[model samples]
Target chain A: MNKSIFYHAGCTVCVSAEHDIVKLVGSENVTIINIGEQKSKISEAENSGVVSVPALVRPNGNVLHINFGAAISDLK
Target chain B: MNKSIFYHAGCTVCVSAEHDIVKLVGSENVTIINIGEQKSKISEAENSGVVSVPALVRPNGNVLHINFGAAISDLK
Candidate 1:
């Protein structure tokens, strides 16, 4: 748990998390990355092993924990 | 109906989707966005309202239909 939490919020994740996760954890604890604009960034996140929206960049920064696409349930 | 589909894959979603969604939908129909690198694009994806990993941008280009992170079932 030494990694920085990086969230790649797309449309669905943003709308849901903005109204859900953001409220649950607050924006302060997380880094929300709007990944719908850049092709390179998106690629980078994937290379980092990111596969979904609302992902939690593990404290160690080794793996990403996805909150599911437009997750109906929370990742935590 | 005019909307373009976008995928913001983090680590979890990527690992799962690479074996799940990617295999189901293949990589051509979807444009995966690795949002773990650039901070700006992450914000952009959020603005687009993308909320999921395997999100389907409606042909109308209004709402994003997320495929859910690490989806067990296919979006189609």
Candidate 2:
């Protein structure tokens, strides 16, 4: 699947999270779009309908918002 | 305005971005929806049409997608 990940220091975890997925999809398969410190990304994010930072996207335009907490993963 | 943030390890940076906004809005004002490892969240994100993790959502149902790199911010 065509993929893209976004990350930044404002949210370091977001950066890391994006990295993990990027790794899973692999550099060749993923279209990495790093926002870094771009405020425009904020607007882009909004225009794209992203509620938060560090978003995982498929070319099909499907998206899932992620929140990492022990509640779900801790069980594992 | 009412606000929400969704994040996870699959995209940790998304998590952090959510946190920062959460802080800005304050716990009392925000409705924290922690997806953790619950697969349902993934579906929720899709149902919501997030198109990415760490989505910043307004009560109005508006969303923003974040990607970090600096191409946009670096200019600033």
Candidate 3:
């Protein structure tokens, strides 16, 4: 499963979601990308329709906004 | 040393600074506060004259903005 979490440094929600995601999926299976560190990925995140940080890109190419209930639920 | 790092999730700079801080002071010595998770701390962070995320509050009650070169230098 190709799972990547695109996040920034100072987003509290993102950190929470990251903890949950890492717990559920195991840290080894996940790729945590700091958007600021990877400047090139900003456009890629934008292309995926992510206007905010803490977006999770699933294997199916669907992006989940971590703040949304649906996204958090989906993680479970 | 009572060192606390006030940070939010999704901030790339904070993550980098956090790594540096943990390396310098050891993770056990520093407290990483996700300002989003700890809502009450937001006001405290603001009260410390921090207008942005990733501010570090030292034991002396002085707050350091992580984006500033001086802050990073001080960490070293």
Candidate 4:
């Protein structure tokens, strides 16, 4: 199975979003690229059209920007 | 005056912390090493004893972990 790419920046919101995405799609089904930890992934993330952290890139290369406000609210 | 090194990971909290620090200490008084933008700085950050992002390294080599909660709240 093709794994989706999850662009993370190691921020609170991104970490929370990761948990939600991983829960939505099994951990094994996604590959996390922490741009904050690995700068090399910044370009890759940009190439994938990620303008911000907590973004999801589907197998087919579709990028979805996660909403930090929504994610934070869900944490409560 | 020696410049303080600010270790950043390009995360929301770190970004906000940077602003506060820069405001507290003039930008010229600090040097920001964006670990998220430069992978090479990871080791440098670790050597400075930065356990997390938004850390400040004094000229004397002391590390201070900025409180993310405080930084975030201050953003409001």
Candidate 5:
């Protein structure tokens, strides 16, 4: 699955949600990118229709925006 | 000493720098505030002349802005 998680550095919600994402998807299966540290990723995230941090991109290329609870359930 | 560490949540540099700050200040002596999560702290940090994240406010009311290396050296 080409799964990626886009997050910003100083977002508390992102930090907290990431723990659960890693647990649910396993660390190796997900590509976690911090947009704050890597500005290039911002374009990629924007292209995927993600305007905010803590977004998840599914293997099917669908962008899940901020609903970490729903994203986790969808991933499961 | 009224020591506080002002940081933004999604800052990778802040994340790395905080580890060093915590080690130097011993967690108990420092108040680590995430400005992104707590907007009120922004004004407090600004009052101390802190314009960016990863700033260290010394007990003397001096703000060390973004100079984590210098801050650590001064703390030690």
Candidate 6:
């Protein structure tokens, strides 16, 4: 299965969401891209249609905008 | 003086920061760019070295990464 792209920014909200998402999809199933530390990833995130951090790009190329206080059960 | 560029994502944190920043420099002194609503501005935000939302680009072209709970007085 293709690894889902997880665009992170290292912020508190992003960090928590990352943990939740990893648990939901398993770390091996997700590719964590820290755009905050790697500015080059900013363009990659933009290309994925991520205007903000804590975004998830599924294997099918579906983009999910995870906002603050997002519940793990709400993740798809 | 040139208008400072403010990169926003329309999130709660970004909205609060926008309010505080506009108050600090006044609306006339800052140009708000909502990358969330206007995905086209994502490139502009990336160009300004903004990996996260609530970023401020001073008139001199210095980038400020504003995180959650950032003190308004700390803005420069």
Per-prediction TM-score:
0.36, 0.39, 0.40, 0.44, 0.41, 0.44
In the range B1-76, model 5's lDDT, one tens digit per residue, is 5455545444666776566446434687678887766766667767776666666666655544432222222221
Tens-place lDDT digits, model 2, residues A16-45: 555544433456755555454555555555
Q: After superposition on all CA atoms, how large is the RMSD of candidate 3?
A: 13.9
Candidate 5 regions with alpha-carbon error over 4 angstroms: A67-76, B1-76
Pairwise lDDT winner, candidates 4 and 5 = 4
**lDDT accuracy of residue A11 in candidate 2:** 54
Instruction: Indicate the docking level reached by candidate 6.
Output: incorrect
lDDT, residue B22, model 6: 66
Error of 1 at B19 (Å): 25
Q: List the residue pairs that clash in candidate 5.
A: A9-B9, A9-B10, A9-B11, A10-B9, A10-B10, A10-B11, A11-B10
Model-by-model lDDT, in order? 0.47, 0.46, 0.54, 0.66, 0.56, 0.67
> Candidate 5 chain A: worst 10 consecutive residues by lDDT?
A67-76
TM-score of chain B of 3: 0.68
- Prediction 3 global C-alpha lDDT: 0.54
Name model 1 segments beyond 4 Å from true: A1-3, A62-67, A70-76, B1-76
Q: Which stretches of candidate 3 lie over 4 Å from their true place?
A: A68-76, B1-76
Name the better of 1 and 2 by TM-score: 2
TM-score of candidate 3 versus the correct structure, residues matched by position? 0.40
Predicted candidate 3 versus true structure: per-residue lDDT over B18-71, tens digit per residue:
665454345765688766556667666666666565655656554444432222
Docking class of 1: incorrect
Tens digits of per-residue lDDT for model 6 on A1-76? 5788888777788886677556545688789987777877777777766666677776665555555432222331
Write model 4 residue lDDT over A38-62, tens digit each, in one string: 8776777787777766777777665
Give the poorly placed runs of model 2, Cα more than 4 Å off. A7-10, A68-76, B1-76
Model 4 clash pairs are none
